[model samples]
Target: MSETAVPLPAPVFDPARVRSAVEERLTTFLDAKAQLAAAQGFPAEVTDVLQDLILGDGKRIRPVLCVAGWRAAGGCGDEGPVLRVAASLEMFHAFALVHDDVMDRSATRRGRPSAHEAIAARHVGRPDAARLGMDAAVLLGDLALAWSDELFHAARLGPDQLAAATAVLDGMRTELMYGQYLDLLATGRPSADVDAALRIARFKSAKYTVERPLQLGAVLAGADVGVRTALSAFGLPLGEAFQLRDDLLGAFGDPSETGKPAAEDLREGKHTALLARALRRATGTERDLLTGYSQGVPPGPAEVVRIRAVLEGTGARAEVEVMIEERRRQALRVLEEAGLPPAAGAILRAAASTLIGPAR
Candidate 1:
């Protein structure tokens, strides 16, 4: 199977092109939903807020990966179904982000006010506007989740394709929820448990972000077990590397570039692998500072500076960079061994390189 002859895809098989296609589908789907809501006399804000968030700045990574997976599996011809599925994944991601913002009490996302914050601003006159916004945001997230399912079902796959897609989607959703729960439980009380942190990363970001999206596309193409396995080999490690990079970004990234506050992870006491590693190595003043901050000591400017110093001084940041490089190498090796056709291999390889590059 590794040596099976495969035809090359068109040169137009570009990430930017695929992203445009996926966004178009999302816009059309959401526009129809908005019309339906209007016809039913539902509040326009529901669809309006959702539209703004959905159409906002995003990398469109999942959908692009899905398309790449299909190509890798040697599936070709009409891309309509796969494009719809990709849009569905993006919609599901919206749901996740919406709820996550409420959970973290985040003020912004993608450089703009978060869903709850946006909703709260709408009812500034109300005394309980903040609480009402949060509750309403939760419902909005549920609506997005439901709409994701609607998009998936409307993709119109065959029986076998539907069954395969269902297996992957079901596992992805369940694992993501479990990972999120674990993360919530560990919040504000970080431990020096690198393994636990990695476990959460695996389920929450790695598998959900990369592996399952690839599998969803592969299965939709009727990919064999070997093909599925190969994609996992490449996707899982790449996904981990991506999350590791994200952890670094969350802790030390520039807000201008990342669109999130620098050291936000430390401020929120997120049990990231970077923090876990730092905790394992820190002691005396550094250890005391991290512990205090992790245990509800609000990180003032001084504390943020001290925490950054500890993370850097302890070599935790450097070690995470090492981890990212290692995982990227592993993923590239798998891509080579998988012997995917040239176009698909190029797409996946480029994705890895772009997503898991050396931190500046």
Candidate 2:
């Protein structure tokens, strides 16, 4: 199925408007942190990096989802507490990204030096550039992780709501770590089952990216069993589609648009659904090339092009696109069935559009 075949609603909240609100909230949160750091005698550069990571240019999708989920659960559209929760999610995300970049040995993120690399670059005279960078980045990630709980605790949630949100946060962190390990493990093996690979992708990337954020918001709003169940039903499939979209971007998205190198996932030997499907469909020389191409050092541009050709020739790219569309449709169906408040559901529907909707 073509991506255009999916019917997406007009987004309920303006993307620009939502983004502005998120930015304002993030600024407030970061400014307060900067003051706290200043009082503690933190170096200016350290505080700057922290603020940059927090207030950097991101889609702000997680926090938006949290707010949307809360609204869907009949919570008021108050920005104060929601912003704190959002900051917590964002902090946690920074923690994940810093560590993920370290594990992948990635040099750039969002079109700039990654946190660890940035820190390392500042210490040119240091005896251990890589080690120092890694260590500094790890420490920064830990700070973000710790701040996540502090923000969560500071939110004006009741005890029960706070407990529930904490549980979701804990599960998300643990599951994501496990998922990352599974991804690393898959690279060593010659072949992977497509279904199993999809499961891992869902757990590792999708839940953390989409499901947990929505669940966190819903729980904060004290959503009932039916409401929470509906949100999960809507979130899981949509989350999977979100990851699938990312997988496509990793392989084929423009480096300029995605703010990362094209085929970076392949370079990291990520065993995504697209790669797994391609491997399944490849034969003879194509299979040999793929097996050899993914191992050892990263493939150069010529090799990456060759790998793309194999994927295209085998129709794996098209097949994965079809799967992406299917998952999107399933998510929409769940939302339609959930019978959420029209306004809230509309916002969620819009959020889904923004998430998986095709690029211009």
lDDT of 1: 0.88
| lDDT scores of the candidates, listed in order | 0.88, 0.80
- The candidate 1 region of ten consecutive residues with least summed lDDT is 291-300
The best candidate in terms of lDDT: 1
Provide backbone clash counts, one per model: 0, 0
Off by over 4 Å in 2: 1-12, 293-296, 358-360
Q: Runs in model 1 with CA error above 4 Å? A: 1-9, 295-298, 358-360
lDDT of 2 by residue, 1-360 (tens): 656677655345555665677677667767887888789988666667767766777888888888778777876646577668877888788888988888888888988888888888888888898798888888888888888888877787878987888888888889898988887788646464788778788888788888888888888888988988888888888888888888888788888888788688776667788878888878878877666745546677898789889889888889888988887788778878888878877878887888988532
Question: Estimated TM-score per prediction?
Answer: 0.94, 0.90
